[model samples]
Target: MIETVENRPQPKAAPLVVHVVRQFLPNRGGLEDVVANLARQTLKRGYRVRVVTLDSLFTTPDDKLPALETIDGIEVVRIPWTGSSRYPLAPQVFRHIGDADLIHVHAIDFFFDALAWSRLLHRKPMIVTTHGGFFHTKKFLAIKKVWFRTLTRLSAMAYRRVVCCSASDLNQFIQIVPDGIAIENGADIGKFADAASRRPERRIVTLGRFSVNKRLDHLLDAMTALAKRDAGWHLDILGAESDLDAADVRREIAVRSLEKSVSLMISPDNQTIRDVIAKASLFASASEYEGFGLVALEAMSAGLQPVLNSNEAYRVLAGRHEAIALADFTKPDAAADAIEDAYRKVATEGSALRESLMQAAHAYSWDAVAERYIDLYRSIEITI
Candidate 1:
């Protein structure tokens, strides 16, 4: 669920801010969680904040919700929306911005980009944070080479600052937009620390939407390869269905005859997530790319060793903390070997690794990260 803080009754000296993201609350994803957490922390700093986002589409559709509603002390304004969840179109976005002192744009949506461009005409300051950019498929890469690059450059002119969630993403963005900042996402260490301590089972876990970029299919293949050697090992896949079809993942498990060894828990709640991580021997992700790998960080905070797929993002993390293991996900056989080694390491040197991971998690706490954002906001305000 989206975390929120009740609007505090403080002296009205703080500036009003409007955060524009493609889709928010009820829409579960890394960007959604970041926006919700930032908003909550911003409220604590005495700012009057509101979110402008698209209405609940396929992923979050239930009963029709109000266009304007209050959640955790912040007002959320939903604009008119159409199209599918992947390609959301929010019309009349400018009309909803109201009298905000600054605008914080999330993702690289054309509608928001156009609005920011318009804001520039009035010397209005806007901050743009590309949430790790879009998943880099061949088609997306082709689009990024031409159309998206031009769009981002033109939009970059409108932003006061461009934020990237990881150094990997910052490197990628600076090729076209030079003034980008890499501020890693923060975690709630206390929440996971409060959960029941890690009770190592041979059980492993990985979480996030079942999307193509996640390389979950490869994860299953690796699990199958490992299970052949160690029948005691098991995997739990938890998260909502996304770009990848859930049925296809199940079919892969069946084809590999790993039905008994792998279990998929779709859309598990927060409490369930804590319980699963608390009992797991390790947390594994076969994702080829990640913004900040928040789930992996949370698992580390809970004292679970992480077995990550080989990628630039995790490589940066691994470089910082050598205990975090990485495997070549493109090769299931090799990935299986890496997972096996990480599992054994947990049994041997688990306590020291757990302490190191907890220290790493504390280095990126929300309290400190929020203060960085507030400081940025104040600095921008001074210049304006």
Candidate 2:
């Protein structure tokens, strides 16, 4: 005779999401910014958030920061980094991933294999968010050839979900992996939004890490041309020198004799950035590659007209906005012309343009993004 069996009920705890990235906190980048914002928003939605990252010895100096700590209501664990900065090794990463209810890994790197290993052994639901192209670049082609097999294996078997920050980014990622979901990055609109009417000061501002892709050289050429037409306007390029040396940028400024017309504010604090952007007449970016231009959105939200380089991603995001002036940044004359046009638009329709920019920014709220992520998490199957 068969015996009747009773079903047992299991207790559920608060959902814990562990976000793994190459670097976090103190080390600032577009990837780092997105993770921090999403983590905070996730916490607000009644979920516990934790960030696992490597201690960046190359990018940031050792400040004696604690290995394990909490930042903005999210628990953070920084494992010591070994090997070259281009390819860091973090053996301690395994210890952290097993405890997470759901795992979200970021970027395309050696550590991707670590996450993939954890996924296989722990049998946890995993998501991998590829910020953008890491393989297509000229510098990384050799490395890509060597690691292509491993990368493909991880993409195939590592994660349940694959996410990209932009539609353009998604298209690039899909060339390597068959499927991906586009989840655009967001800016802190409230922090950048200005309530008062904007009065432009004939000043332009741009912010981004110093890298070849940023094309600061091209921007300087455009500024030189702009200075020839109008000496009244000045440009401020504010940001950390990550990939490109600061000396090289200064040398370019000297060659163009744009010392007075252009200046570099290296690595200013967050408040200083807000203050500078708030007073700027125009905001600009000459970046040849952007996963998602969060800084451009921030500048727009702050009521500054944006003069952006022509690209599929920016063009898509700009969406025929009369406020965004697009130009081929490779050509100095073209870039200068676009900047002038954007400046005139701001001068003529300041309040109206500001309103339109705010409307665009409102559509990319972090709260909305958080809700989407929470829904994604709840839908995924996780073992208690």
Candidate 3:
């Protein structure tokens, strides 16, 4: 039983059609969540929304997805990329997205749709959401930097609007296009709330793909630091491991003898993740960089206090809001102290602070986020 918006405004003759382009759907990670949620929300608003995604041999048609069915009344069409490289796939993707009023591409860094839309399908109003530039290690950053430049240049020429998940992401694109819009990502607070209530214990949790950019090793280091001070503290690391460096993380955890204190799990479904967050006391992230900390927001929604690095993305997302506390992980003892402080703050403040955090979380609902995108879409001038 999928949720659909029954009462919605219609544009007289036919529903306003939109094609959402992405590399993958219903797989895992923040980008997948964003695409799925946006499609669902748009369908709720009565728009004829279809998700256009790259066909992966790994992802099957039977995969469970809210967007897979007409959740909120949106249609989804997953297209296969027949070509081997990005350049060859551009024509195929553009062909699939034919005749759509608006084409919204997410994670434009790795996808070929943006280049295709720019070079081939110039008639349609295209928008790109730059999730974030991958800032892994020095080598990864150097390689991605070139891609970033090329994408930005192509986007400036082809797309009507460039949207970023956070101010930090917008800053990265500003080098290419100065006026990109910042639309903060949203979370399903209700789902997270429901998940948290069912789980037991106040466990510390961190969520993300196990990649170098995620800086998960730092989290392990922080856990080691925290365990030395508070023997009762435990951590759960949950996410997919697609990179080779994940082997390194396993070795580090073993060497530190954190097998008991820390637990590692692969990516889980939204409800399963919520269940973990509900039982947890605090949510912690050690990423050196982030486009937007959606997991931290989910933890906060679940009434778990957030302890995150004092990076630009976290600061922008959680700073003005009092729901989360910041930690300067650059210091020797900052991570340990931050975690302790988060627990104490939640304990002392009681349900009042929790209520406020939940309220803040609602401000980032997908429905509200959809309105921002709609406004951006309407603002684009159709070229003859």
lDDT string for model 3 (147-226, tens) is 76885466566766778788888887888877788898888666677344332344688887776667776777778888
Cα misplacement distance, residue 259 of candidate 2 (Å): 1.8
Question: In terms of TM-score, which candidate is strongest?
Answer: 1
- Residue 345 lDDT in candidate 1: 81
| Better structure of 1 and 3 per TM-score | 1
Best by lDDT: 1
- Runs in model 2 deviating more than 4 A are 1-12, 61-64, 140-150, 195-197, 320-322, 382-384
lDDT of every model, 2 decimals = 0.78, 0.77, 0.68
What are the models' TM-scores?
0.92, 0.90, 0.83
Native-to-model Cα distance after best TM-score fit, residue 342 in candidate 1, in Å: 0.9
Task: Please state every model's RMSD to the true fold in angstroms.
Answer: 2.8, 7.4, 4.2
User: How far out, in Å, is residue 116 in model 2?
Assistant: 1.0
- TM-score of candidate 3 against the unseen true structure: 0.83
Give the range where candidate 3 is weakest over 10 consecutive residues by summed lDDT: 57-66
Better of 1 and 2 by TM-score: 1
- Candidate 2: the clashing residue pairs are none
In the range 228-282, model 1's lDDT, one tens digit per residue, is 8889888989887777657877887899899999988877877888887776777
